[model samples]
Target: MAKALGIGGVFFRARDTAALAAWYEQHLGVPGFWLQEAGLTIFAPFPADTDYFPANRQWMINFRVDDLATLITQLQAADIPVETRPDEWDTPETGRFARITDPEGNPIELWEPPAA
Candidate 1:
């Protein structure tokens, strides 16, 4: 039985594709195709009426990071505002999370799974 192993890629359109790609590379170190570390990959769909993320946007991208705090600092240094909800978002089972937006206003979630 042939089946999909994992998410091969995530493709999206941008107004200025080149500039957006460069922003991703410079800020997130994601050079188009990244060699992500082997770990859990969440594939959950939110409820239609849920307000977890912005309602205006159709989707949000979550990236698992080794160090969320460090990334948040770096992002802030680059003048990107990071939205954090430590009280409500962090947990012993899951992890800490922080949110940021791209130059084009695309929401990005940075997650750091609880230490194993």
Candidate 2:
């Protein structure tokens, strides 16, 4: 059977399109329409009241990062807010993960998967 394998790109409505795009480019180094290395991309929509993600949030974008701690520090140095849970947030099986919110109040999950 034919099926979608991974996400091509994410498109969303923004109040100030140019400014918002610039924010992503400036802070996150996310090149618009940028090509990336090979990996699986998950495209999912949770229930409106789902606790799988933040309730008041519209959506969350998770990016696979190379170094979580360094990236966190870099973002903090830039005065960006980042969330971390030391005790129960991380697991032995999977690698470390951290959370950050974009200027538009969108949740971003920075995940560093366990090394192969």
lDDT of 1 at 50: 76
Q: What value does the lDDT take at residue 100 in candidate 1? A: 93
lDDT of 2 by residue, 1-116 (tens): 99976677889888898998998887777888877777646678888989756888888998887888889999999999888886757777677888888777888888888787
**Model 1 ranges off by over 4 Å:** none
Which structure among the candidates has the greatest TM-score?
A: 1
Q: Rate the local accuracy (lDDT) of all candidates.
A: 0.92, 0.82
Clashing pairs in 2: none
Error of 2 at 89 (Å): 2.1
**Can you write out model 1's per-residue Cα lDDT over 18-101, one digit (the tens) per residue?**
999999999998888887889999899999877988998888999989999999999999999999999999998999999998
RMSD of each: 0.8, 1.8
